[model samples]
Target: MDNENNVNKYSKEEQLNESRVNHDDQKLTTNQGVGVSHTDDSLKAGNRGPTLMEDFHFREKMTHFDHERIPERVVHARGFGAHGHFQPYESMAELTKAKFLQDPSIKTPVFVRFSTVVGSKGSADTVRDVRGFATKFYTEDGNYDLVANNIPVFFIQDAIKFPDIVHSIKPEPHNDMPQASAAHDTFWDFVVNTPEITHMIMWLLSDRAIPRSYRMMEGFGVNTFRFVNGEGKGRFVKFHWKPLLGVHSLVWDEAQKLAGKDPDYHRRDLWDAISKGDYPEYELGIQIIEEEDEFNFDFDVLDPTKIWPEEIVPVKPIGKMTLDRNVDNFFAETEQVAFHPANVVPGIDFTNDPLLQGRLFSYLDTQLIRLGGPNFHEIPINRPLAPIHNNQREGYHRMTIDQGVTSYSPNSLRGNAPHPTPDTEHGYAHYTEKVDGKKVRERSESFNDHYSQASLFWNSMSNAEKEHIIEAFHFEVGAVMDKQIKERVVEMFNHVDGELATEIAKGIGVAPPQNPGGTGVTASSPAVSQENTNQVAATRKVAILLEDGFNHHQVTQVMEALKSAGVHSEIISKNLGMLTGVDGQQLEVNKNYVNTGSIMYDAVYIPGGRQSVDNLLQQGDALHFVNEAFKHGKTIGATNEGVDLLVISQVEGIELAALDSQAELVSKMGIVTIRNAGDMGTIEQEGYFSQQFVSAIAQHRHWKRKNKKEMVPA
Candidate 1:
């Protein structure tokens, strides 16, 4: 199914396609719709002479081309987006009157953009950095934008520090040496000085930073919001988007290699998935607490740097979003679509979180400049489904021409048109949360306990996860030229965990801390760990290694099982073309050893054939591919003479099935091997060896296996 679009009668698609222009079979024309001929050459005095000044066509064409580009976002410049619809599981009329949440039957059209925070428009997609997961919903009330990030918490508690943090993480401005990276002196210096960044830095260093794909990571609002009921009551709420596919990440080694192998890796993954009808799905969840219980938590709910742990305020699944369509044009829809946190509908209001409050002003101001004035909301991608009113007039790029004689309120000529709807009606009414605080440049004392939550995050990680965090710290902090900054960072993180700091210090050649203490908050928030998320093999990509003269029946049997198990498999060989097996079965090779690497797949399989196995053993490219997959802790499987290739590959101390008489199938660790199997099961139900391989892949990665002794060059 190329598109499952027929399953949904989505209104958003109707609106978007209304403006779509297909130039097929159409005559070329100028901007004024005047037909043109001979556009190949400019209107010139002669064949090789200067252009004529009276040629209006050339002037119009060149002028438009000159102004084609717009300013990319200062942050989140490189982005990929998709069209989707959101529908709630059930109505939440009691808690909030937001129409989108009040009906399970309605599908609200949405545009979601996934991006990297620090990189420029041309940066690699797989860089180790924070990802932005902002969604714009064309709801009936208005376009509500949920500007979010992959990390649940943020680097700073207040919005004033956003500039400082972004400036620090970006490459040192003087030299601009390291592009799309935070491995520099400025970032480390910022971290050591701002203790409020403690918790978020831990998250930044975790595997979460290097998501396997946009379809496989979690997103958070990173701010406290309000859910106002129709009865004029409110509750504190935090938003979350949990991917249906389990949270997964590429190892640092794979991520670094992928940057060179494919800078558009994540973007291509999303586009391909949707194009193939394997639409990415995410469930919208909300963590709500009563307005009266705001003071019940140890940390301030308004602090952007603190997370309301799921165990404490459980995430109630409210709705699901599915991205079923790719954009027709990237620049028109994805790039120009403006998103602002303040673009909320009725029954939804903002909290007093300093970050949220400042963003309300900053996001609008940014669009004014980037999209060229206040008319950005008039853009097709940013327009709302709801009707537009008010006396506001447009400025630059204004498309609307007012048809009214009187544009001001209380004008007799226009009969006082577009009268304001009151709270009794459907008009938006801001929540009446009383506020009285002294004007001072200070953070609340409640936001002071940053180390506690940072400690909570460290303790919650699995051993392998913790090791990755330590390694990330070593890589990031060690790159700092100033030894003093590196040492200060280690000492600062000593507050999160002494062992974590010690391990990082050892790797970076920094001095061990004189005193280290695990922040007194030792309680682990298990829900924060990726190890605790869902696990499945659905939609996983597997590379099937094959060559001419391979066992056709065995290959068919294994592939059928993988297909039935919802795994995507591709045939790879030394060259791209057709490969014929001994039994005359032919397979088309889509990718070759030189083009595709082991880092691109979730698992690998090899079917036995004397000619194929013999040829593969002699090729360094083929051998390195298998060894790299094993070193990355991915599942490996082979059958009959294929087992000989694994043995010959000689991946150091790693174990493989022997050739001697034994059971037909042998499962050693994550590697499944079979030999001398006379009776093969039906394709529907594969043999034990194939089943074992599939099961191993379901576990994502074999983290427990120690590959230090069996390391292979990747």
Candidate 2:
């Protein structure tokens, strides 16, 4: 069933819409709604004289403007949010009594914020860093928050070490030189000292750190929580959000170039997608372990730096969320929204996960300062649809005006108003988890094995992913000025995998470990590899290159096929305007070479035309576009005379149909070429070619071409 049909059923979106104000045809007014006759000059004693303090309007306006800015979040500062609704595919009543999960007919209104953990408010979005994937579900019971991250693991196992890791990964305080990067001496030094972080470091260096788009990445709750049923039976659970588009990532080169070319690349992609009705969708999956089976695993269930292999405990998808609406005002909604991990409704409870226990307090504490007050929840985006009634009174920016003769409970004056709720009435009840432990600052013994999973992660990687991880280590560790720290990093990783450490040492100028021994964990989890992710051409963007005298029939035929396959195409040429084909067919260009580049698209296509090919061959920009795209392993398509341009572009190591061939279609190394395409008389024949092109794009990247990519000049 289509999720788009349920967009208007969300009460949260309708509530937010009520707060939206239009400035068109409205008179200027002050905070107290006093209509002002003048506001520009402020009430002055004379035209050039000193202004008087008696001008109340001037004082109020200036005061509001001066205090308009609030403190930005310390981490996850760069965030983008969208509104959506979630619906369960089937009732999960057997697992949890959470009202939102128990009902299949109810659509829970949700607001999701995607962010980068280490970046400042103004930092670029494409930085290689952990991304925050926090979601707030406004249910009938209350607001249930699922605060998560793009990576399933974290750097430190305990939350108390959060500040230290943040300090080391952030720009060095002395110079603050490397903005939004972990490539420095401090981070490597921390890595060498903190052995438990080895598993997370492996993930950080992988392609998952740099997602192709926010819509394509995965989300994990990171810490374990509890799912309590109506019978009070509890199970350990971990949350996951799997994007329907599949997991994809950008190459290091593309990410670096796009950071400078467009700092807001991720947010722009999300905004544009929703505006065009190409809403992002994710299925909510849970990995659950019965209370009795918790100790059956070798690793501690409470450790935050570990993942339960999907093969062992498969992910059961419970519901789906569709982000069908964009925020009307970024500041009022995306900026002001608050999320706390402790925001649980009935049937959801916490575990003894130390990292999660620490976050329970930290998230709320940070929001108090960042959002200016505890009353931040009163903000339209954060306010829940459930009725809120309590004895608690006013604070800074409190929107509610409580009325009663008595504000305290247990008084005859008001007959005990705002009484507590029982379990039968859906009141939140903490699971009765037996606890018998001493209060001490010590970690459990079960949390000590850090290298086993790290080795498993290394073993699970496909050859292409392994190569990317090694190159990532080269860039990150190679930036460390301290040679001792670099050598120590190599040694620390030796425990995870001998070959991985040796390869890391090769790039960072460190000697290979003297005793390069792995954890001897040979088992691999195929689910962790991006090579096994879903592949589809839907929502993929393709850039169509054309100039005057392009083949209109070929362009029209291929574009129709792409559209039918749910692909978006844009005409990119030397200049913006109408281009006349050889057959006198005109088409408008969406972007010009000066304003856009090859990095902005997923793939490239060139339609055949004698004049267009001749003109493109002369322009260095056009050849560079083709070469650069090929270097990045993106799909490239050429039809008829378009094949001549690819040949001149010097994308070698692949066989292409010769210019004289008879309707030959040569598909090799993710490059599709057709010779004598004008000879095709039917759309069916053209569709076969288009189908091959789209299928190539679906593979995301042709890693087999990486070995030959270095030969390209661009």
Candidate 3:
């Protein structure tokens, strides 16, 4: 193969670098690369009449700007992307012949796009909606795209109903009042009418919809696919991407506040984490079942609205993917990069899953319109790392310059060049499964049982999680003005759990169902609960509430401890400048109360200093910050004189350290307090105090504090 066709000779980054332009010291030019001498004024009559068409430079500039915007994606429009690489833990040649998963020594370049499903390009990031987690792997065989979602189950079963579901959940066409929210009448009406959406509604109302970070959520292939091994053995498979950081979510209230305060909160978090070298990592997992055992499950393996309980079929970790580089250009890369489920390699194959079948067509069709034309694959970000020798010719925005005269096959003049690779040579061959089904538009009976997994998900939730779900239902369902729709929602969910329906009824002003139906499946999957996830202090952010006259030694000790634990601490004061400590030590402030609030941080901390606390006690913003953090169940820490600030705030129930005590610590309900300023200075000598506080931060939130949260007023 020539150098141009031999992509393996250069790394993916190197191939992309061929197109990257510095533009720092270069002269301005038109699209044809012709130099432009004058651009400020168009060639016109007397410099003010109608612009002349002969002003080629001005016309080119205007034409490019006018056509700069493409049609935004119908769904998953609000997205962020990053460049990374995937490496397998060990060889998986026994299961599949996928080159990326068959060798631990190779790193396949990958691009991942994280997005919200039901929003426009300008919607808020913290909206309560299913998130899109799509990855494009540039492998030796070809580009393998793993199109997934944060939630395992989808709202609809058949692809034919996709349009209906999307239309119903989107804002009503007439008013379009609510932006990026499901709390409306049309959505509830659709839910009550579609019983198949019962299970997905349960997940949508759960905390999973409002993830704390893309780095902290799990991505599921959703559709059941097939894995074909080297010997032509095929197995049904479901792919999973598990974050190394435990799955976490923002409290509903916090998520709402963040939507208003910072619409780009998630985008900023990802960019900042990567810039700070805190690369996000997720392990790739696959749940495989023998093709013969497909009929053994209670629910259809091909149903998109069901889950193969991890308790039944455990997820096996296969590889890991780390997103270490952010995209240099949002529009050129993240927006233009297209992902299709049909973009598969030799090992990965598709199932007869109805949703998956529709996606195979819908994704490609949409990309053709969303992007300019059929040549979108030639876009640098979407190009593959394998050799390209197809006879495909020009289309809109075609970048390739073919040299052959015989574009057709079986031609003798060009010796039939660019011949197809046979199955023996690793060419993709579809699994040869017997198919004798009817042409009628119908679904299998095995996909009928939808409430069993929904019930299982509800039963698996901890008490705190259950409460959050109930509240979420209240907010979402209660927004409906039509009482019939609200009543139908309660009746529909009654099948999942009688108590859940009753709780939802109480909040939505509906009478409890006299004969609440319940699914007989009493089992639970522990893996579905976020409470069981691993918690670590690493990558957590803390707000250090400091002011003029702060304790230098105490602040230094706590900050150093946080650094050692891989936690990020930001010094926030009344102003964004150097703050003077009690002993004349100066500390730089990263943020100020005017620009930031407790909603931005995972926890709050205040160091010892009589003057600092005195000043904070008088500032309404500082007190509100503490009160709001406590109200949201975030960990709160105060040392010595700083303890007085906690006592004076709206926080209650937890006993704080007494002022006169010497080096005493009081840790309760995620609040850590040290009574002695001297003991805080001894943090390096006796690290127990800081360790306890760090452990509290690792818990993410102290839900026990919810009992008294209603009493606090921020």
Regions more than 4 Å wrong, model 1: 1-70, 650-654, 661-663, 678-687, 707-710
After superposition on all C-alphas, the RMSD of every candidate to the true structure, in Å, is 16.2, 16.1, 16.0
lDDT (0 to 1) per candidate: 0.83, 0.87, 0.86
lDDT of 3 by residue, 1-714 (tens): 687766564543443354255767788787899987654333433311223446566445544432323698878989999999999999998899888899898999999999999888999999999999999999999899999999999998766466667778888765575888899877888899888889999899999999999989999999999999899999999999999989999999999999989999998999999998889999999999998898898888888899999999999999999999999999999999999999999999988787776677668777877787899999999999898998889889999999969888988888888887999888999988765543333456677887898999999999999999999999999988778788898899999999999999999999989987789779999999999998988899999998888899888888888888888999998888899999999999999987889999999998888899899999999999999999988999998888899988988999888667567778899999987656453234444568788889999899998889898986
Model 2 lDDT per residue over 208-234, tens place: 999999999999999999999999999
Better of 1 and 3 by lDDT: 3
Clashes of 2: 0
Residues 591-685 of candidate 1 have per-residue lDDT tens digits of 99788899999988888899999888888888888888888878888888888878877455655676876656766667888786643343244
Model 1 has how many clashing residue pairs?
0
What's the TM-score of each model vs. the native? 0.89, 0.89, 0.89
> In model 2, where do residues sit more than 4 Å from their true spots?
1-70, 679-687
Sort the predicted structures by lDDT, highest score first: 2, 3, 1
Pairs that collide in candidate 3 are none
Candidate with better TM-score, 1 vs 2? 2
The stretch of ten residues in a row with the least summed lDDT in candidate 3 is: 44-53
For candidate 3, give the lDDT of residue 500.
93
List pairs with backbone clashes in candidate 1: none
Worst 10 residues of 1 by lDDT: 41-50
